[model samples]
Target: MTAVQRPVPLSVLDLVPVSSGSTSAEALRNTVDLAAAAERAGYARYWLAEHHLNPGVAGSAPNIVIGAVAAATSTIRVGSAATLVGNVRALQIAEAFGTLTGLYGPRFDLGLGRSGAPAPGAPAPPALEPRDDEVVDGLLVPSPFAFRIAPGSRFALQGELLGRVPGDVERFDDELALIRDLFAGTYERDGQVVDGTPAAGADVELWIHGSTGGASARAAGALGLPYGANYHTSPGTVLDSVRAYREAFRPGVLDAPHVIVSADVVAADSAAAASELALGYDRWVHSIRSGVGAIPYPTPAWAREHPVDPAVAEAVADRVATRFVGDAGHVADRLAVLQRVTGADELLVTTITHDHAARVRSYELLAAEWGARAARPAAVEVA
Candidate 1:
């Protein structure tokens, strides 16, 4: 078999939005426009994120957003950078993307996350609902229920349970088995149709997404899914989580275990311009450190006016140091190192710049930069 090339596919992790002063409708429109631009710019894929209760994050319903993006762009893939699986159920998710697949073909990827978006500074929840459960009758898909049926009586009685059911449930194996069976019934060979459409291809590429290791890696391995580590905001786990994923992986549907690391990136005409755009992200990070709610990207003037705490600013800088930034060449060099370090089959770039046009330009430049890097040979083995 031919070895996979290094400096892999460059993709965008978009949180589509208007600039700090723009409106929501405009943001949504801009998102569609941006996805189309990325497609034209030769980016491999454009993935949106699911963030709830944050005015700053416009891509809350990734599936809906993906639909818009996919519809607007012909060949560029559109996916969820990470969808909180706990908020949505498996059948719905399978159906949602299955429909997209039918519409867009091989250009859909499902990046699944377990935790909900917590307002910045909010404590991580005591418990998180896992993605695997979201697929079967175990956890209800996040969409509004189809009908007004009382909770446990209708669903549980019909031998279908959505969301967490109480009590002494079986172990992971049992849960996986049940989930598999349900998906099989809904989207497998003997698939059924709801509202007159067939359900098949639940075999969609499922990606395990997270900021940590252990359960996420083990679960993804056991289920034979791809894994994505959130290196953008959670840089510490970039390598360890990928290592765990590869070690725990067993060959199945995927030829081999693949890891995608998310990285924060900002590119501009000059180093000064890039750093200026990064100020918003730095402020966003500082707010996160102070336990303030997820704050909007500050204006260049605003960022300059309000200096962050020295410690907070340093912490932001350190985390972002792992980020790819600067003019195209500077950022591309960093991407090469990152792609080498994590053995990511793809690099998912997330830019936190508050300027809408700046954000779009940054991705366009990175896509062009990485497109050339992808042509060269580099070590593919995980470092």
Candidate 2:
């Protein structure tokens, strides 16, 4: 009920990061605790993000975590920021979420990330040349950073390690279609009727996650599915992503475009305190971008002592710049700007710090500030 106090509702996206010197068991416990705290703090929904082979992140299985989170909270909707198309079968996704709905009722958002094949009839986005940050309506839309993993790198070998071969990978579009059909209980393959079991009748909302004006955005638009643009992950391309989706939009599942945008944030009792907590973020980001999986979040002190390679740091520089870090009120104001610039229907927050308590406190403080925003701005400034 209190979620309505803000100009726009705020939701949470958790990576369930295991901090330096923390165990995965403890991290999982924190995930459950944070979900409960978020519900109590009046955030709209809770989303768990998936990561593979991350030493610092414990949420490799977001669906399983979603189940645990859903069971612990009473009113908040729980689901994935994404359950990877490359990782799970469409049938598996349907059955798993279908089963979740059977147990927890219909309060779920089955958000999916772009993987596998592009949607049919959707052409690739014309590549936007990467450039410096461009200010639009006061929001900093940085240049898109191209993510690469050197061939033969451990990260590049993940598919092989996962027992996946190129020829065996399922098309993203095919899985999406099959999932919809399965949910409708009308799926058939080779003249044989396909059943989604409990999933067939589940009322879970489907969503598409995108970072650019690419096929994913087009597909979401064409299908009229809810689209979540990643300002937090791809600040440079988020505008392009949202614009593309809206441009391609056709009435299908939703009568109009429904969009959510995400941001990286860190809040503390004071702006100085928040800046300190967020100081180590670049090192954590570098770990992932460097073809090594996420290392446990580095303490600010450790980060200062052991600086990342200059090139590595430079690559993730935009993320460091884009993070909304400050005191509760300060962070809240920035989030409002983000929502406004992106014209987001809702805002998704993902915060990380070396300590679990600090991370939890960040969400709590932001929630309090957001709820107290009686003088929020109206109307969007196109980003």
Candidate 3:
């Protein structure tokens, strides 16, 4: 028998949620505290996500939040769960992340995604058409509707809110090309070279975050960049996305395919306690899905008293159901299964609760249990 490999690393994905009756300032402070805790707990990395115009989420600017977190912690990698590349220019992103890498050295990563980060009340863009060469289950296939953002949905309105003219937002592939060129110091427009000075030689790790088996996955594969599948957001498509990524993989920056999978998790001392902590999750998800934008995270008592409407509850049941909630051992068991199913090189856990203490404790418990499990030896029988 051969020796078993080391356990996959565990990381954190924080939304920096503002609880009911809490201010954004307080939410940001809590984010700093959580990052510090994650670093102390032996977690591999700490990532903040970008969400604009959401009252409950304080991470509207992930790069800024990343700077703050990096300052507060001495170790543990810091980065954006994603920077919503679609809303910003390639040169700007290249410079920003390059500067971050400069200050933080090898401890910074740049996670890019196509989210538009639309502001409230902005008009939505037309749905995206799938590429003709997209791969599905080991086959190259065309999906006319592979990616669709509903009209008037928050995501569809991102370009408008960012002051982009209708149809001005560059196609994702073109944007990626520009970003690569800028990073490699080969960017040119109209025969004039463009340079992203400090970022040109920065050794920052690039990861693509995607929820579908479309362009994002394919791009990451072909470029040999790490891919992060959003099981927390699109559980139904996680497998397909990872599959698409591995299938299209080519050796570039990375020698082989590397994938990280994100999940929703809430752990407590007991199953009952965990369930209580999770009560507010369904309602919180409802606010986002309803397209009115996310409201402040409600307290457990408030969530118990103000039950979600049946229709709204049904709409978000799949997401709520996928969340891992229980004691540390139970949650770890579930996460292990998820890792096995996804074949993820790393696991990114995101937890949102009304109480910041509970949220921090959840990470502590998970890290302890996960570390213990990884250290345990495989049982063997003498023949």
Task: Report the C-alpha lDDT of model 1 over 267-315, residue by residue, as the tens digit.
Answer: 9989999988887666676554443434666788887888777776665
TM-score of every prediction relative to native:
0.77, 0.91, 0.88
Candidate 3 has its poorest 10 consecutive residues by lDDT at: 138-147
What's the true lDDT of residue 121 in model 3? 44
* Comparison by lDDT, 1 against 3, better one: 3
Question: Candidate 2 residues 1-383, lDDT tens each?
Answer: 12332468899999999899889999999999999999999999999998877899999889999999999998999999887786778899999999999999899999987542222223333455878779998899888887654655545555555554353323778889988999999998799877669889899999999887888898899999999999988899999999999999999999999999999999999999999899789988888777688889989899879877888779898899899999998898888788878889999999999988899999999998888774554434353
Winner by lDDT: 2
lDDT of 2 at 205: 90
What Cα-based lDDT does every candidate model obtain?
Answer: 0.66, 0.85, 0.81
Worst window of 10 by summed lDDT in candidate 2: 116-125
- Top TM-score prediction, candidate number: 2
Error of 2 at 110 (Å): 0.7
